[model samples]
Target: MSLLVCESFLSIQGESSFAGRPCAFVRLTGCNLRCRWCDTTYAQEGGGTARSLDDVVAEVRASGLRLAEITGGEPLLQAETPELAARLAGLGLTVLVETNGSLDISVLPPEAVAIVDMKGPSSGEAERMDLANLARLRARDEVKFVLAGRADYQHMRELLPRIDTARNTVNVSPLFGALAPAELAAWMLADRLDARLNLQLHKLIWPPDARGV
Candidate 1:
């Protein structure tokens, strides 16, 4: 099976626990949720290259980056995502999937690290997050929240104790340009929220609107 891919490129992993690491990114097309502050609105639709699983894996293998991230406009929208993720993992690379947390990740391969985008208030899609996915997490899985303001941060803080804090990596990222990274850091320092703050490392290295890494 193949996927409608927005673009596949090599860049430093920008979010989650893998920030700043060299990684290959496979950004698929289409999403089920439309968050108001979504940064990748371009990925929401339009032209994409439809590539077979072999071709996708070949592209990642050619990048010379051992860490690969399968991101979206919700990659799970593509039914064959599990196969693609498993294929990438089979190639001896550390495969990570950045998902919108609304899908059933229980079927994802064990070798793939799942990064659930746990939407907080700022993202209009907050209510869509399937809380059950939290129970499916393994030590390799991570839950990330992109905060646009104080309300979003506080909402995430309220959710911490209920999450699988021991087995899961809870990451809190201030919406790249929406919230002041320093301010978010200070809040984390004050309340002692046990979540890792993520910055868009790729945006720091290149234009936020630029594509193809």
Candidate 2:
């Protein structure tokens, strides 16, 4: 079977707990939610390129990177995504699937880490998030909240109790350029939230809008 792929490259992972690690990325095309401050909107539509699972796995293998990420648009939008993640994991690669949290993440292979995004109020599509995914998180899985302001932070705080942070890594990523990292850090510190502040390292290493690493 083939997957609709947008682009794939090897670069430092820019988000999640795996940030800064050299990772091969497989960005699939299409998304169900339209977050207001969405980056990579270019992958939100279009058929992208149809690539066989073997071809995609071969490319990641050639990257010579031990870590690989299946990102989007919204990676889960494609039916073949879990298969891709499983394929990567079969190769003994540390696989991560970056999903928008609007879909059920339980479908991914246990070996593949899930970096699930929990849309906050500012994303405008927060209501679309599948709250059931909170209970489905695995120990190696991560849940991220991209906050734009105090309102979003509050939303995250309220939802924290529902998530088993002790089992899964919780990440709070302030919307780049929109909310100051220090501001979000202060809020987290004040509340003693059990979540790490995740920054987009790629934006710091290269131009904020540059693609393909």
Candidate 3:
């Protein structure tokens, strides 16, 4: 099977809990929602080089890294994504999938770790989140919230306790340049929130607009 792709390159893991680790990125094309603070709006299109499963695997493997992240404008938009993820896992590579929580993720392969991004109201696209996906998550999966300000943070803080954190890991990241990390950290400390803080390590290392790793 083939899939649309935006760009594929080897770079440091920028977000989530695995920040700063070397990773092979398969940035698939297209997204279902348009968030206000979206950094990768470039991925909102559906056209890109169409590569077969083997071709994609070869490109990732050639990077000489055993870690690959199948990220997207929203990867689950592609029907073959589960197959692609399984293929990558079959190669013994540690595979991680970054997905918007608005899609059904239950179809993905067992070995692939899911980094599910749960949209908050500040994103202006929170209603799209598929709440059912939360029930399907395993211990290898994680849920993330990207906060833009105090309102978003407060909303998420109230929602966190209702979520089953033991079934999956949870992460909270402030939108870069939109929210102060130190201030958000202080609030988290004060509330004694169980979530971990995440920073975009790649933006710290590379220019924000740069592509192709």
Candidate 4:
């Protein structure tokens, strides 16, 4: 089977607990939701190569990286994603699938580390998030909330207590250029929220717009 691949390249993981790690990223094409602050809007459509699973795996291996991330416009929208994840894992690469939390996370390979993007109020797609994904999250998995301001932070704050975070990691990232990092840091500190504050490390290390890093 083949996957509609937007772009595949090696770069430092920009967010989540795995940030700063060298990773091979497979950015898939198309998305069902439109968020106002989306940085990868170009990935929405019209710019992808239909690649066979074997070709995708070969490119990841050629990157000389052990960690491979299947990201998107929305990876789960592709039916072959689970097979792709299993194939990469079969090759001994740790697979991380970054998905917007609108689909079923349980459908992915059990060995694949899922990074679920839980949309916050400012994203406009917050209501579209599938809350059930939080229940499927495991110790190796992560749930991220990108906050745009105090209201979004407060919304996430309230949403946290209902989530069983004992097994999974929680990541709170301030929307780039929209929310100040220090502001979010201070809010988390005062609230004593048990979540990691993640910066888009790749953006800091390289220009934010630079692709295929």
Worst 10 residues of 1 by lDDT: 158-167
**Highest TM-score among the candidates is held by which one?**
2
| Candidates 1 and 2, the one with greater TM-score | 2
Error of 4 at 137 (Å): 1.2
**Deviation in Å, model 2, residue 20 alpha carbon:** 0.9
- The estimated TM-scores of all candidates read 0.96, 0.98, 0.95, 0.97
Write out the backbone clash pairs for model 2.
Answer: none
Q: Which of 3 and 4 is ahead in lDDT? A: 4
Estimate, for each residue in 1-213, the C-alpha lDDT of model 4 and write its tens digit: 899999988888999988999999999999988998998888888789999999998888888899999999999999999999998999899899999999999999898999999988888999999988877887799889999999899888877975667777889998888889999999989988899999989888988888776
Q: For candidate 2, which ten residues in a row score worst on lDDT?
A: 157-166
Query: Whole-model lDDT, candidate 3?
Result: 0.87
After superposition, which runs of candidate 4 have C-alpha atoms over 4 Å from their true positions?
none
lDDT of 1 by residue, 3-70 (tens): 99998888788888888789999999999999898878889887788999999999899988889999
Index of the highest-lDDT prediction: 2
